[model samples]
Target: MQKQRKLVILGDSAFAEVAYECFTHDSDYEVVGFSVESAHLKRDELFGLPVVPFEDLEKHFQPGEVDFYAALVYSQLNRLRTRLYQEAKSRGYRAASYVSTRAFVWHNVQLGEHCFIFEDNTVQPFVRIGDNVVLWSGNHIGHHSTVEDHCFVASHAVISGFCTVGRSSFLGVNVALANNISIGADNWIGPGLTISADTEPGQLFKGESPAASKVSTKRFFRLKED
Candidate 1:
């Protein structure tokens, strides 16, 4: 810890706002404001913190003077936060990471720089996590489980408490992995998939959906142009 630094959260969602609360409660960084790309500005305030445009935020808080956290949850375009990570680095603001004091990180576990691991994560013994990783709430990472660089693990995903998560992979919410399974690099595991074997590199596995039943127009509401 060099100086008590200023901070700017890069999103306005609950996760970002809550992280602000978490950081302030445990650290000395004062959160200056929230920021986002111009197109998706929500309200002007987040948890009583002022909101600002991402491009112009540097004017108010110099990049070197303050640090930033992406704090954006993964959704349709999971790569969005990755892009923001690069953007922040290019602009000279060091990215900050927050590992919750409540997490069960074992002695042999390793976490890289800029990893924001939140509450209730059970990172077991010998588990290794790479740089730029984000582990959301209440996940179970089993012993000897290794998550590579730049991966995102959604809330409640069960990484069997030996499993190896590959680099740049995205594990959807509630994903279940069997013990000793190794997922390859650049793969995407969709929500609720039960993976029991090693997957090839660049593979994607999604849970099967049940067949949809045909319905008449009366089953759904329709709005007509006025």
Candidate 2:
């Protein structure tokens, strides 16, 4: 087992905050700071810890001594967490992962660097998860599913057997991936989607729209204006 020391949060999201709490409670990690990308960042503090810029996090916490976990949550937008995780790793920052005590992971399951498997996730046998993944709460990873590098699988997603989720893919909440499927790289799967076939690289998949409510446009406008 690696000796846990001072840890750093790599983003300013609620996920980062949750990781801070989880690590402090369950592990030997002492969270030293937070980090943000050069662009699209605000402020300089998270819960009183200095918000170190992703580019210059090392100035605040050295890589050799301090471990860092990217705390970005995946969304409809493409691969932000994946991009930042790779950048941090390239900068020589050690990526961290959390397998919650409530989670059930098989002893032989292989989880690579920089992954966070949250509460109640059931990781079946022979699963291979690559670097920088977030398996949020209540996910079911069926046997032999390979989750590639930089993928973010949000809460309550179901990845069935023999599936291959490619690099930088984002699976939104309640998504159900069919067995023996291959999700290509950079794909953004919207929430409530069900995929049954191989997705092409960079594909954005969405669910079928529900039939419009019987309410007329006038009713819709009135509801919006209210």
Candidate 3:
């Protein structure tokens, strides 16, 4: 059997724990430890492994001895993850990407470093997913689509063929983009929205909740009222 590569995860949030589980069980990487900023280092251990400070990470585990995965979410519009990913690279630690074994990625997809592609994702051919990107479970990246750097696409998103999602964008769950759509940088597209046209940079698309019906459930369903 091939030797497993050692890895260090940066962050202690729920996402980090999920990453640990995925990498430990699904991938060929062995998670040695976790790290966070000194200020946010609440615990000294996680999953029975050492949780060290990011500032002194090199001292604990040399960069050359292990790779890194910035297990962060779309905080700060993904800028935080991007910054830490770049910083880890600058510190001479190679960034690692995780693609779930259950995902279906086409042969020609171009996936970059520090990416986390969850289960049931369908990545079609000629797709380009940039660095520091996160594709949550059950997403569909249609053919010839490009999801730029530092973007976070939540579960069940549908980016149709020839679409382009710009850098640092946050696409919420169930967001669907029509074919040839161009989503601009720093955009925040909320859940259940369907975008058919191009959007400007930093645009925020929020879906409105449906209004409550004037008729009560008892009236609608003919149920007995108390």
Q: Best lDDT goes to which candidate?
A: 3
Every model's TM-score = 0.81, 0.83, 0.91
Question: What Cα-based lDDT does every candidate model obtain?
Answer: 0.78, 0.80, 0.88
lDDT of 2 by residue, 5-84 (tens): 88888888888889988887877788888888779579888888898778777788887888888787764332567677
Q: Predict model 1's lDDT versus the native.
A: 0.78
Q: After superposition, how far is residue 222 of candidate 1 from its true place, in Å?
A: 30
For candidate 3, write residues 1-226 as lDDT tens digits: 2437999999989999999999999999999999999988899999999999999999888978899999998876777788889998999999999999999999899998889999999999999999889999999999999999999999999999999999888899999999999998877787888888898766667655322234433343343432
* Candidate 2: residue 109 lDDT (0-100): 95
Question: What's the lDDT for residue 43 in model 2?
Answer: 80
What would the per-residue lDDT of candidate 1 be over residues 1-226, giving only the tens digit for each residue? Answer: 3338788999888878787887888666788888988899877887787888888877777878889988876543245677787798899989988888888899888888778887899999889999778898889999989998778998899998488988778888888899999988766777777788887666656556311123211122231211
RMSD to true structure for each model, in Å? 7.6, 7.6, 10.1
Worst 10 residues of 2 by lDDT: 217-226
How accurate locally is residue 203 in candidate 1, as Cα lDDT from 0 to 100?
Answer: 66
Relative to the unseen true structure, what is the C-alpha lDDT of residue 87 in candidate 1, on a scale of 0 to 100? Answer: 91
Report how far residue 59 has shifted in candidate 1, in Å: 0.3
Worst window of 10 by summed lDDT in candidate 1: 217-226
